[model samples]
Target chain A: MYQTISENQRHEFIAKLQPVLPEIQYYLPSFLDRRILFVMNKMGFADWQNFMSYLDNDHSYDAIFSFLMVPVTEFFRDSLVWHTLFHTIVPKLIKNDPCHVWFPDCSSGHEVYSLCMLLDILNVRNRVRIYAGCKSQQTIDKIQTGVYSAQCESMLVANYKNAEIPYDISKYYTINYNSLICNPELLSNVSFIHSSSLLEDEVPQISLIMYRNSLLYYTTDSQHTFITTMYKKMNFGAYLLLGIKEGGNIFGLQALFSTYNKDLGLYRKK
Target chain B: MEIATTYKLIVIGGSAGSFASVNHILQELPARFPIPIVICMHRLKHVNSGFKETLEIVSKNKVVEPFHNDLLEPGHIYIVPANYHMMIQSDMRVLFSTEELVNFTRPSIDVLFYSVAQSFGKNAIGIILSGAHKDGVDGLHDMYKIGATTVVQDPQEAQVPTMPQAVLDVMKPHYIFTLRSMIAFLKAHI
Candidate 1:
């Protein structure tokens, strides 16, 4: 029920891959071969050179990125992680002072909206500013439109229950025909920005960054550089959330941050 | 003479009744099973904790749910983690994605099979097992189109015949195996 794509998806992947032949060149040699061939097969391209023929058709970039992307994600993904964010991290962040949350690469608006609901329920929505940054204006508009398939309501409700956030799920959205329109007031303080790279337009004085599942798209070096940039910009003891699969494989940056929960990819700035 | 070394990889996919079949295969293989074997069996996203451990308890070879960008090792068994789509690169690195579910299931059989078709092609073995969905048909067909050895679990022997039957409805695979014959084929090849 939580699956949706951003219009900036093509551009964002292009931005991430612009470095090396659409960035496949920079993938660990092993990753490059594995993914290239996989993509070729999925798209019915005959071979490597045929796949590389993407340079010939600009339109093919979208198709290529679509295959590679874990592009759409659900709300309250890894419910345990959201629970920890609400019960443990939010309290700590609020105790420090007025706070801001950045979803540095929010391809889908569900997670961003999920966080807003939690903040509103905590009655701390007034104290916090949320910035939802996306690569394309289409995604920005989609977030603003805020409608979801009615079928997704049950899934979202289950996730909310699992996340242990206390609130009536029905109060957030109203049903129309076959869709649910999220209440727009949730984002009264949330700002939408058309920025792909956090390295370029990062908002300073950030208390929390929900940059999960998006990191693996970059080559390892790019991953490191992005992390290092984020590390320097974050506030003292600020919280960083990563995808569950990413924490262990990030190579060496373990010393730069301490893990709040190794199981859920929550890290605290050193 | 061992594991028909001509094939570099084997990918198996299923839903519903595939667990026992997968468990039996892992239980029978020797420790040095030769080339890698990756399975994409569907399971609940929230039921993530003990699957790999359960498989390892029955496997002669080490079993793992790969982390992102992991290099696949020969003689090992890799299970696609829950809610993640898995694929292989030409270099044998296993990758995972949280993309929209293909065939309405993550750990899609088609994603893994089509990927190995491109990566290993004729040098791979693609197997379909018992399940309730048609997920493995296109993937197995991709492998067949690429000249990889393709096998379907005999629908008559399948716990849920829909999946194997679905593949049979499309095209003939190289073999139609019962779980017992499938084990014998592997042991004989080794």
Candidate 2:
């Protein structure tokens, strides 16, 4: 459908979205181009003008934003990084005062739950406080439900095995109606926030921040803004983990943080 | 055959016994090569250390694993990090997806080739090299359909022939050269 649109019409369509969801400016044109197709299809519109007409309708903004912000994450998505976090980083953080961990973009709470499992195995679950942040209230509500699709069970098991977890992963969940409900007791200390790192508002200081693959979705300038702001919200000697492919040197981040383990995308606040 | 005057990107895909051949190709390129190159080599998920630094030691061009959101730049070789499928977004920045595997491989050759076909179209150049199985044939076909220059390693000389043979069986690539001749072909055309 995008191929049929004129180049000028495409830009005009993007310009229409710029004000309502100001964050679109932070994404690359190609990424947005692909996503806009998904957006148009979800909104039940075939043409740009139809999309525009619906946007002008009453109470459409929230539904559009929710569609654009669907969470895409899996349990132990990057197993090797989780391995290092469990064996090295988590132990180091626990040695300090009761660890305060944060997941700035907790897209569906996979990362948060992964950390919970690690802390549980280490027998330090009582000594931690987790702050999981999301871009939308709808996602926050979904995370609170603690349900994951049954189709992902095999992949989740494979990831745990890859991470070398010694115990059976099934102990953590109860299967019901094609979904896995994570044990409610394990989530007792977690708090969900409807926030973005780019926001300048005050947030709690954290000891370890897991801001992974989501950074690639942002524009470079937005990346610089969010990373620097996130740096200020972290406590002294905190550790920051990014996606294995997320190189941090572009924004003078090297000057602010020392390379903890380049392969794992771990950085230590200097 | 007509040759394009220039290209926006060059993508190379290989697996199995391709490391030495790719290393030789990288060693042959000039320090400030005019176009950016992306290489996708199938690797074990557990083996994730020093592939970038090791390549940097021998190549004239800078070798680095592109971070997410990293913009494409000339004179550098972007190594696709293992365990993830990489796609080039319309903005020409790197987008990594942890979606289910394709062709039984993450960082699948076809995934990168399809994205390059979408982003660069006729302005892209795609090369398929030595591999154990038919991983890159579909990608080369996608590049061919989009009017991009498609090349493959000569199966006769490849350490493993299944990959190049599959492409030869499906469609005629623009060039099928051995490692030594491939470097010369690139210098002459690129």
lDDT of 1 by residue, B72-147 (tens): 9987999887877787988987666676678888878887887888789889889999999999799899889878
All candidates' lDDT scores? 0.77, 0.78
Taking the true A–B contacts (Cα pairs closer than 8 Å), what share appears in each candidate?
A: 0.47, 0.34
Accuracy of chain B in candidate 2 (TM-score)? 0.96
Q: Candidate 1 overall Cα lDDT vs. reference? A: 0.77
Cα lDDT, model 2, residue B38: 94
Cα error of candidate 2 at position A258, Å: 2.6
Count clashes in each candidate, considering only residues at least 3 apart in sequence or on different chains.
Answer: 3, 4
Deviation (Å) of B118 in candidate 1: 1.5
Candidate 2 chain A: worst 10 consecutive residues by lDDT? Answer: A1-10
Writing each residue's lDDT as its tens digit, candidate 2 over B113-152 gives: 8888877878888999999877778878988988889999
Q: Which is the leading candidate under TM-score?
A: 1
* Stretches of model 2 off by over 4 angstroms after superposition: A1-20, A41-45, A58-67, A70-72, A96-98, A175-177, A196-202, B2-4, B7-9, B14-36, B41-64, B69-77, B85-111, B114-123, B129-147, B152-184
Tens digits of per-residue lDDT for model 2 on A1-270? 013345575576667666655666776565566566667777787878777777666343556655665455568877888889888888888887767888877767777877898889889888888888776676777777878898767767878988986877788887888998887677888877765433533457878988876666666677777778778888888998987777664465687788888767889888
